[model samples]
Target: MERSKTVRKGTAYWILGVFAIIWAVITLYPFIVTIFSSLKTNDEILGSMLNLPRDPVWHNYYVAITGAKTLHTIMNSIFLAVCSTAGVLLFGSMLAYVISRKKHKYNKIIFTIFLTGIVLPIYATLVPMMKMISKIDILQPNAFYTLILIYIAICLPEGLFIMAGYMRGISRELDEAAIIDGCNTPQLFFRILLPISKPALATSAIITFLACYNEMIFALLFITDKAKYTVSIGLLYFVGKKTTDMGPMFAAIILTTLPMLVFYMLFQEKIQSGLTAGAVKG
Candidate 1:
């Protein structure tokens, strides 16, 4: 009987291994092609997509970084993403803490509103938002602050939801202890609650930052100035009215994608732990 069980388990492992290999190839093949194509000339790329390059052009990277708007766009993306993530973390956590801890009559109503935000599609509101912003004059020409505000609004719902769920798991006894020790609301939050909620906060931060980093449609619609464009928008500039520069475009693509890949690799373990820790308790 034991031998039969062992054979079944081995068969299961083999099946899973085959599936894993196929999945990896499906995901990684495009990235491999992009990297290899970036190292070839436009003529070589046009001649044959599958053939190896006759001579690898390492100058693509140099031109992408120095000759194009790659560096400026990268900085813009990082700045917007960082600022928006910070805003979401700060205001979202505060709102969650209040809703979770307070026993006011309106707490349930406020929670319902936040939950509604999660269900609503952002694209549905874009036209109304554009009209309102245009009327308010805040959507002035070349303003990045407008984009930042939009990011904060879009990210707040998920940030608050995650934080509220995490806060539910924290002990109420800790709040009572802090109150007895004469700690004010800010002190209780910053010193005690925020410190304890690091895992959940990190998870929210990563998600918010990535969202802002990759946002394209709104950036394309709202931003017109070349100087204010993010990496996502800047990449589209590689395609001209007449022709597309495939080599430098791929090089730019690789550069834009590498940072996010590195970031995910660094925080992937922590994100998994955060998700499981908040969900499961002894």
Candidate 2:
């Protein structure tokens, strides 16, 4: 009986190990190919897709960073992502705190309206958004601030939802105590609630920033100036009407992805904690 059970457990372990390897390959293959392509020259990339580079060309990294347009694009992307994240966190959290703590019929209505934004597909509003942008003339040409506002608007729903859900888990006793101490609404949120909800805040900030960083369609549609283009838009410039430069394009792709990967790696623990905390409480 013992020998039979041991054999069965060993078989299960082997199958699980095989499946893990397959899953890793499925998720990681494209990234591996991108890294491989980034190390090769255009000619080498065209000649061989599967084979490793004979002589690794490291200049692709230099070209990606030192190129004037690429440098500008990187800065634009960083500014948009960071500013949008900040706006969403500050505004969304405040709105969420009010809704979660206050007992009012209008709060429920406002919350529902904000929640509706999540259900609506952003692409469906493109025409209207573009019309407004044209009328406002703020994002004219390639202004980074224009993209920042758009990103903040797009990210608000999710940020609010996550924060409100997190606020539900917080004890009401804290609010009562703050009120007893003569703290106003703004003081209560900034001093007490905001510090305690750091996990959720980090999660929302990272997600919002990444969304703005990776956004392409609106960036392409609104941004006409090369200097104001984000990394996503700038990376596409490597492709021509007739042919695509696979090597440098891959290098640019890797460069664009590296920041996000690093951000995730740095804050992965906080993200996981925030997600888990929200899930468990909500």
Using lDDT as the measure, which candidate wins? 1
lDDT of each: 0.84, 0.81
Candidate 2 per-residue lDDT over residues 137-247, each given as its tens digit: 555646777777888888898888888888989999999999999999889999999999887788788677777888998899889876688888897776663334566
Model 1 residue 98 lDDT score: 91
Per-residue lDDT, model 1, residue 19, is 97
lDDT accuracy of residue 3 in candidate 2:
94
Q: How close is candidate 1 to the true structure, as a TM-score?
A: 0.90
Clash counts for the predictions, in order: 0, 0
